[model samples]
Target chain A: MTHPPLRSEAAELHLSHQPAPEDLERPGRRQLSPADAALMEQKVRKVEVAISLVLRVGVLVSVLVIAVGLGLMFAHHRAYLPLQGDFSYRQLTSGTTPFPHSMASLARALARGDGRGVVVLGVLVLILTPVLRVAVGVVSFLYEHDLPMALVTLYVLAVLVGSFLLAGV
Target chain B: MTPIDFVVSLALVSVAAGVLGSLVGLGGGVVIVPVLTLLYHVDIRLAIGASIVSVIATSSGAAAAYVRERMTNLRAGMFLEVATTTGAVSGAYLTTVLPTQALFVLFGVVLAYSSFATFRRRHTDQPLTVSNDRIANYFDLHGSYYDPAEKREISYKVVGTRPGLALMYVAGLVSALLGIGSGALKVPAMDSAMHLPMKVSSATSNFMIGVTAAASAGVYFIRGQIDPIIAAPVAAGVLLGATFGARILGRVASTTVRLVFVVVLVVISLEMLQKGIFP
Candidate 1:
């Protein structure tokens, strides 16, 4: 894709006379080589890709875990099967529905090979996905040498973790 | 109902909720809560718990592609998370200690207002050329995204930073207290207050809602509100539906999307007001 030399040269002359307004509007506007622009775009794109991958993987894993748990539950609990009118299902979702809520109880349920415990673990994974995204943002910002943003992201992470800890207790 | 019948029916309904929620950045709680409580006859607390977990699934699942395509202004989302996460944590705590009937009425009124505001400005696709907001500038909240529907790159500057952040705090609080993504509030804040393009606003809101929901998800879990039996199917269905919806977002017209969002807001507000007044 070669532009005619004379046309390109004339275009350059026109650009020299009237620079692109978008260039002037950019913060810290200055001359930047095409290579530099590409490099910066590449860097920004890398960060986007990384964040995207984290989210995709998190979702994939959580959904799979949940599906597996559902499978296990149906396999083990024949009484709660959909064949007949089962009060067990109703009781499990009712006002006094008894299930593990705390970590210690959850761990005990899991040790007993309870599928509900595995499903809860999957839910925990879903809840933490966005927290992990914040952690990634911290690293991405630090990599770009953006101290302010890194600190902002770190603060968000701290608040999320703190809320979890404070709530768990 | 049998266990299989229960799970399958709930999952099917949740898939519809997820599609709508993912498209509007609303996290489908608007649909999940009502369907589970009103239609399924589940307890309200259990319904809310399932809805909150579904919100996390919807946001993260939809946000994956939005981030990849640069529709999400990650910087803007992160910056606002500072305010939203704080608000959410407090809101989670307050849910146990405070009475919320009045708050529900107030939130409904606010949503009605936001719906009107969003409708009034539905046609402004052009981004602000100049923003004097020092905070937005300092944080580089400005960004550009490629719009496949328009087939062009759109660059935009952010304005009204202070007001946007304030609205987001309220959004977070509402979400935590009500088990919603609160995108009904967030899209308006970004569209009218911050003057971002509609698609960017929607995507960024979607990106932000997950963190906001995650902030309070642990609290709900500890309170025994998050029943794994109810939540597991909802989460899986929402994620699947959200993945499909995310593919359609970039191809849809922004104004059409905004209109759909405004409709959701109006309906939800009316429902909220009805519950507050009657209950």
Candidate 2:
């Protein structure tokens, strides 16, 4: 008897149904028994939920920071005041955009409380969301005792960090 | 244009790009790059920098909802990411060494062919059930998702793990070299080579593209390519649009998704061809 895919199980991992006992015995197939598959799905679902939360929170925070920065720019920066027909950001696009693009410059700009600096910070946060999601994956995989996957996730994190360091160089 | 006019106008355009991108698994960079460079007359480098940020915003924003809905295959996405990130780093290094104009032409031809092939099979939504691949089974890369359009649960197994990784590596390399998320390549790699259902392939591609983009994004950032005044609105708008797009994906049929993706693929291929031939 097959079960209706329960709403509770709707978010479960890859394997959602049970393989017949004989199906598990099929050589080279590596089918997990129904109960074991359920357990694995449960664990995977936990990790997925965590990752979802991380993504949602990261994006929300970054968007909020950007909004605040935009507000600050309009409120304090005369150059950005609305409907100034004489003023155009066209000059900024012509290689004079006053914004931080590197860590050192970002740090300096933040110290000065520049609105562009705040916006850059938010951009950085957006870039880092995927990196943070990978970090969470590493921890969760380890907790699940999936060591090979834990190591795989760790390697990905290393590559991501290495890319950052090399880019700085 | 005035800063206010600039920000609001660009944000509105980015919202459209984000909705289309999130729905099709292509990131907003595809649309953002051309619009910024051609329409806004922004420098190509700064446009690329901003587009990279938009790609991440699309991925993370749409992925947040996709994962929660079980549309994204987490294990498959994570496993494929290893290959893509490595390829991205290597491609970044090779950028100074490779004749990218020729590569652009080559990939354009490849994409044109794929767009044709994808259109031919647009109506097939059947997910494969049997798989003998030890690597896929060992990694538990198989998955199932509830399709609201079909009103049924779809279960599928992954095959061709090694081939899928190879294709993803190439996709990542192209993305890094071109400064766009190559989800056009990624979706086919997953759907054709790995036999993931079309929706699964799209959602999983959405999940994976961010890491690939993020790898190159750091390099773009440090090179002073990213202009915050521009990138800020692009990111915010893409995120909002992606969130909205993710809601629509569940209700849309798989064939509709394929049709849309094919159309975008054709356009991108033509643009790529024009870039190579002209430049």
Candidate 3:
């Protein structure tokens, strides 16, 4: 689109008197140049917001579940008796140590409303936070039509998810 | 002590660790691991399992602020994460094969480096001569963010893409093996080699550590290392503390945070070294 010469010249004059780079309070104002770059910036901003929300929610839910479990576990002397000798954390560090069998079993207990199950659910969610973050990244990059970056993030998500498969989960 | 009492004490300690870690920019793992292994007498694997969980918790909890600020470079973080996640998986497996003593020694060495770097800190790195690289271009691993401190937008291009990728692999390996956030190494790699500004490198490093720790966490989880009874309170405490720490960071003087870090890291580093040497 062609602008009138006088209007174009006025726009240039407006730009020339603009604030110095250091005086620009908003970082995006300087960098959000050209039409295409601005669009990319907006998309990336959305992705960041989405990622932050996912993480915050994941942490909040996990903390709540764990708090409930702690209240229950210590409400009486149930979990108190054996905790001394348990200080070495012997029971806490073995493979397939018979906590709730598997994630499915944990879910079942959660349905049953057991304290242990609630705690397990919290842990599971916390662990899955990064997986979810990467999943969002894949979608974010794909939305931007940046295949290399999308694939890059996809590879990371694959490794994270693949470990579960390798672990026989 | 009663289990409740023990758990309470552990949580209190973890809260302190989380505060100091976040304040010192080491995250919580570096502080918690030593406290757990040396003071609590928890097995390294068990302690590591909990530390890794706390790391994820803390990282995720802190993500929202950095992301919204746009200090974190999404494309750069994603590209580097490919290398980090793979390295982390490999390192996690190595933990099963390697002895605990070896981990202690490695942890001590890493802590020493972390301490030295913290003491002689450079919040903004000196720019590298080379300003661009092919892989960086391919992945679009460059970014610009508004720096409120400078009152301007800071734009930078990444360089030494291949070297940065390799260093990231090492960072991932260290993170998995030590159950650390690995920002200590990742920041340097990006700041020095990749030519990212200090803000972007550290912010981006923070993002990658979460994903990398998650990759190793799965293996730890399946192995029954993540005991909810122990992990739940510890993670909760760290998250609470980290959140609080971030809020107060700007008010606290940088010199003070650095002084605290120097003292903490020096003590932790020596303890880990002794444990490794004696064991």
The digit string of per-residue lDDT tens for model 3 on B1-279 reads 555665778788778766665544456787777777777666677778888887776677666666777877878888988888888878867877777677677667766765665455445344332333556655656678776555667677666666667767877876776565666567656654566765566557667777888887767776667777678778888888777655444344434545675676677668768878996
Please, what are the lDDT tens digits per residue for candidate 3 over residues A91-162?
A: 544443456537677778778777767777788788888899999889988888878888888899899999
Candidate lDDT values, in order:
0.82, 0.84, 0.69
User: Which segments of model 2 are wrong by more than 4 Å?
Assistant: A1-31
Specify the highest-DockQ model's number: 2
Clashes of 3: 2
**What is the C-alpha local distance difference test score of candidate 1?**
0.82
In candidate 2, position B158 carries an lDDT of 79
Candidate 2 clashing pairs? A14-B143
- Over A77-166, each residue of candidate 1 has an lDDT whose tens digit, in order, gives 886775567454677789798888999988998999899888988888888899999999999989987788899999999999999998
Residue B269, model 1, lDDT: 92
Error of 2 at A119 (Å): 0.4
Which lDDT tens digits does candidate 1 get at residues B208-269?
88898888888888889988889988998899888877878999999889899999999999
Candidates by lDDT, descending order: 2, 1, 3
Report fnat in order of the candidates: 0.63, 0.60, 0.49
DockQ of 3: 0.23
Q: Once superposed on the true structure, which residue ranges of model 3 sit more than 4 Å away at CA?
A: A1-33, A76-98, A104-112, B23-25, B95-130, B248-272
Question: Candidate 3 — which pairs collide?
Answer: A27-B146, A95-B223
Q: In TM-score terms, which candidate is top?
A: 2
